[model samples]
Target: GSFVLKAAHDAYVPAGQALGIDRDVFSKILDEKIAGHPNIEIVAEEVVSLDQVPRPTIVATGPLTSEPLAKSMAEHFGGDFLYFFDAIAPVIDADSIDMEKVWRADRWGKGTSDYINCPMEKELYYKFIDEVNGARKVEPKDFEKDTPFFEGCMPIEEIVRRGPETARFGCMSPKGLPYPETDKWPYAVVQLRQDNKAGTAYNIVGFQTKMAYGEQTRVFKMIPGLENAEFLKLGSIHRNLYINSPQKLRRDLSSRADEWLFFAGQITGVEGYFESTCTGLMVSMFLDAKLSGDEKPEFARETAFGSLLYAITEEEKENFQPTNINFGLFPPLTTDLDGKPFKGRDKKLKKQLICLRARLRARKVASYQN
Candidate 1:
């Protein structure tokens, strides 16, 4: 709480969009704070096993947890406790998206019209699939060779490999979302979901891939709205470690097997830097509460903190993937402060109201004292 984050406006996105920071500098700042802390230790030794760890421990062994400890963790946690790989989807600059080719709508018009769908005809979609089938993939390294791919975050290339039309049944499906101009269903579709509150970025939903960076740019540009797209991040797969918190851990992030054992960071199923950092901060509070018998701060359900916590701990138990704190995770806000329905589909104003609600409620969660 005492440290100041150094951030700069990200120029790649639309003006007043997301901020960027040098993560290396941020890590150095954290190191300085930890070094100055009286109770902390700067040990270089690696932990070999969970058995060796004392009770009331906060196990935050990151994505690349050492082999021996990983095994010990699996043995203790039981029931396919940890996942090994992270298939991350690519993000695009919103300003670069061609609004003409893509239309915003909820699937079947059943929910909020937040998704931007890019429709592709049968012939064109198959031709694009041909390119994806042949594109060069980034082969997994020796150490990552045995890592099993989870079905939930399957790579786009892997889908294409199953069959030419296999993708139509999965993420590329046009089942409910109608095609623009024709008012009929598209043969296939590529959906883009908003990645940040500012609406400056959208991610290629279910496009987590292992294609080479150059290949990703060349191949994905085949999509209708992305012909001249500016990619903020390319799809890639890496070895990551995250447990299914909804099934494995409690509300306070303590392991079900032992109340005193806590976990945090990416390993706790939160994605991105700030989400991980906040989880680490919250776990310390939970641990202190356990020791002193004090009530833990319960983050309000409407706040970003609570939305993220709900994602990891209360979302459907099946197909739990690590996630970033996003507006999509927030509880839906249909009416404004005056209880008036959103007369116009003004997304900016809707998001602003959610933010305002979070700000007002976050005080209670931040008020906890040890």
Candidate 2:
């Protein structure tokens, strides 16, 4: 997946013919290409019932998919899909914002001033902080257990519950920027940023919340500029579904029963940002070969994609949870260089070398493709 085609071509082939690929942008382009094809009809509305969908389908409804569809998918696949919950941030209509009261600035003006700062007076910030602390939360369904959200991505309400200064240290840390009006840094700032290319909507950065929809709108509006803000969507916490990939999905990403259907991304238990994208690439490669009547290429266990796929699909199933790419997942070094297992000045250098090896292996695999 780190096959920087341009870098590869530049390193090995002639100049000007090199074409580098940003895997993230490449994946989105693939999605758009698949959506735009004449033979494909991507539906905007959710398929409420299986009766409405066509046969021989791939149900990639993702984590936020509905219960009925999820159940149907599970039933058809001949087993239950493992589930978990994820909290989502709320979206606000940009047009509804009173931008006159907000200023555009990045903290300390270090980064791009992409963020719209909604500054708060010391008194107002404290009051809002207190309200979040006192807000009520709804419990999850019986099958779902309430989990502490990830430390880096905790909901705003959760942060407030920790203490009065929690939000300041986390989301509202006014370390760098100063307010012109007061000539003093704000006590806290609720930053909003453009969510889409059109700039018609913005997201409440670090404002993920478990508060009831009704309560969310009421309390959020207490912010000065958001007094009449229109919420496009409220924040929600939900369980995410994941199968034990080592036990369920094969190395080819297909289940034992139906080879035609493939699992990719988080549903297959490939965790983290790049893991999901790598899974998608593997699925595409597997399917492309099968569709074209060619033998699928086997990836080396030492390769990045290969190591990750093997880790997810070949690891001990019972002990399995989501995993990010790490040295432990890769085939270990055999030599004891410099009185250690491997030779490197530090862990960072070791990882860089491992990444380099993986990319070379990926290029070799790609060369085998038609």
TM match of model 1 to true structure:
0.63
Model 2 over residues 1-370: C-alpha lDDT tens digits?
Answer: 3442322332331111222233335556567667777998766886865456653334455555687876776775678776554667788998888988887777766555777788887898898988877777667776676333544456888788888888888788776657857667887888886665456677787888888888888888987678899998899886677766777677888866667767787777766656776787777778787888889878888797888889888877564666667688898654332335675467777777677777776778778763
Expressed as tens digits, the lDDT of each residue in 1-370 for candidate 1 is 4243322122122212234343444556667777898999888888888878789899998877877887887877886655566688898999999998889887777556778899999899999999999999999888678776766678989889999989999999999888656679989999887766467788898899999999999989999999999999888887887887898889899988878789999889887767887788788878887798887778888999888888888887566777888889999897776778756578888899999989977875676542
Alpha carbon deviation, residue 219, candidate 2 (Å): 2.5
Off by over 4 Å in 1: 2-16, 87-133, 139-209, 212-236, 339-344, 367-370
Tell me how far the alpha carbon of residue 70 in candidate 1 is from the true structure, in angstroms, after superposition: 1.6
RMSD of each: 8.1, 7.8
> Lowest-lDDT window of 10 residues in candidate 2?
11-20
Count of clashes in candidate 2: 8
Task: Note the residue pairs that clash in candidate 2.
Answer: 6-19, 6-20, 84-239, 84-240, 85-238, 85-239, 85-240, 86-238
